[model samples]
Target: MTVLPNNLVFRSITGPEELELFNRLPYVQNDELADDLARGRRRPSWMWMALDGDRLLARLSWWCRPQDDAPFLLDLIDVDDSAHDVDRCAVAEQLLRTANAALFPDGVPVAQGTPPPEFLRFVPADWRADESTRRMVEDRVRAVERSGAVPLVERLRYEWFAGYPVPRPSDRLRFRGIESTEDILGLMARALDGTLDAHDRLDLQERSAEEVAAANFADEFANYDTPRTWWRVATLPDGEPVGFVIPARNAYHPIIAYIAVLPEHRGHGYIDDLLAEGTRVLAEEGVPNIRAATDVGNVPMAKAFERAGYDTISAVVNLTWEK
Candidate 1:
């Protein structure tokens, strides 16, 4: 454990039994901590805390694919809001710096390059208009910034309840179950062209579209245990491929994992058809909720979700150490 000047000590939780102590500053992931730990998506060593005596002042945790041994996302970070005199942001920054060094001593992971794990924080949809909420979020952002991470993207998160009206499938295009993984890979690579997604665009800077598509497939799309038959490719009546959608239940919720209109098929409102098909598939499965996200700047996607009866429930900001 590292001791700080203000009698604060930083260290990882001793074990799953210490989760209650770590949950002092509540967040959305509180309920999943136990399951995540048991399922191997989280490890005690990846969960760190900065404590003032017996009080939990700040906490940071990373999550990863259950089958993978390395951290995939730095998803949870929080500081006690009620601790009036504490420099909470500073505490968070220090905790992040210490944990990151211990987590990535070699400065890189073999699968993902430098700063493999990116920080993701969920905030209220109108966080900026709410002073307390804004402060709570911005403080964490500033702390991560202080630890050498830069804001990469801010995405609008949406949710669709079972009762929400899903659009009728398009008459212009027909949807079919994915024929094979190679087919989806080909379309994913093609969709990267003219992509407005912040994450995809960032990756395209250093990697080819095919390489990025393959990486996404291996790291995410292929990892979900949900039925692969739920994936669909939308093709024109003439049998020309337009786009595709993957509706799958991830570790948490049933989600429209991906939807895209091919570069050549853009400007025809085909995205709506793709999204609707994805939502319809999940709703038919009797899922209570379906969730999806798109970059805040991707107006077309945001509008499509709104038109399809999905509500903007929150926003997620992703930050990463400068590569």
Candidate 2:
């Protein structure tokens, strides 16, 4: 029961019975909503909307793993496009503030995912240059910023379809499954020394590089619902490790979860071979597509992905509120 301007009422969907009302928002597709509900990644109480009486004006929703009681991210927030720019920003800001207070009283970090290029086909060809679309996007981003969130990183999402050509593996490096968690951690420590991953770099500001790398490894490992046998380490002919790649299935698709070259071995162009091996592993699995992401600023990694024949599918802007 939060108060608002324009005689709007702010609240979560009443229950499963009000799902239609929740899904009726212009931004969400009914089929996608239904799929998420069936998978337990979304719940009625996780969707909060600002309504002008019975008319929906704004909405915010959080997503989480099926087994988790708390949400891991705030992925969706939308305001009515028909509203004035100032009003739209105000409504969205208010909705987010109220939703944050109710859904995350303990002040957990908030994370969001942006759709990739493939998903933006419905948008106009020049949407990025279009004034209205640009303003709307900026307004929403500003509203989120007003709520104490900051853009954490910009990542380029890449996809390798089944028929795409995966580069032939270079015999210069040998690929093998990870031996043990300790061994992998030791490699991760070395990988962090000259890491270009934005999230990893940002984390180094607050924690020791090793601690940040370890925490990242743990967080990623917890998300894999698939076998860890897909993980591979690349080494020289003499068996000294050069780098590693983790090819695993996430909640949605098979992904190159983590790939890194040791700081000492970096400039030798071994990353291309490592990436090819990871893609070859997933391609052999016959998955429709293998998805991967790298920080936009990480030109070497981005180049490796392109050379491996992965298409740039989308760009993701991750905004985070840390406490």
Candidate 3:
């Protein structure tokens, strides 16, 4: 446990028994905290808090895949917004700095083979337009920046409910189950050309498109325990490849995990068809809702989701040690 100036106690929760104490500052992930801990997606050591004696001042935590041993995303961080007596931002910054030093003394974990986990915060879609929300969000961002991180990207999150209209499957393109890993990886690599997605762009900068495709396939898509038959490849009626979509349930939600249009076919409204096919697959499963996210700058994809009856429910801010 690290103690800050002014007698602020900084340390991780000792165990699940301290969850009630850890949850003093409310956030969206609170509902899943218990389940996440039980399922091994979170661990007590990964959750830290700053306190003034018995009062919670700031908290931080990281999350990861159930099968993984290390944290993958720093999804939760909060400062007591109502506490006016303390520099809440400084408290948060100190909490992040201390936790990260203990968690990653070697700069980056060799097991993860990337930079430290990025920070994620969820906020209203109009986070910037509202003064109070903007202030709160920027405070956390500034605190994170002071801990040696920078804003990476903002993404627009979307959700489609059961009552919403799912676009009809395309007549111009036929959808078929994925034939083989190699085939789909080839398609994914080709789709990376001139990509607008920030995550994809980041990978492309460090690795070949094919390398990124194979890595993503192994790290993300292949890790899904969901049925692979739900994955689909879109092709012209003449059997020429157009695009593909992977409609699957993730740990948290039924999602259109990925949908991409090949660079050559991008401008012809084919993305709408691809998204609809993915949505149709998940909708047929009778899910209550299907959630997805795209980089905020990817306006075309955002419009496609909006066109397909998915509501722009919220936005996600991602911060990383590197740009």
Clashes of each: 0, 2, 0
Q: Root-mean-square deviation of each candidate, in angstroms?
A: 2.3, 5.1, 2.2
Q: Give the TM-score of candidate 2.
A: 0.87
Candidate 1: where are CA atoms >4 Å away? 1-5, 108-113
lDDT of each: 0.90, 0.76, 0.90
CA error at residue 51 for candidate 2, angstroms: 1.2
TM-score of each: 0.95, 0.87, 0.96
lDDT of 2 at 319: 75
Candidate 3 residue-wise lDDT, 104-174, digit = tens: 88767445467788889999999999898999999899999897788889999999999888787658999
Q: In model 2, what is the error at residue 207, expressed in angstroms? A: 2.2
Q: What is the descending TM-score order?
A: 3, 1, 2
Superposition error at 242 for model 2 (Å): 0.8
**Poorly placed runs, candidate 2 (over 4 Å):** 1-5, 25-31, 106-127
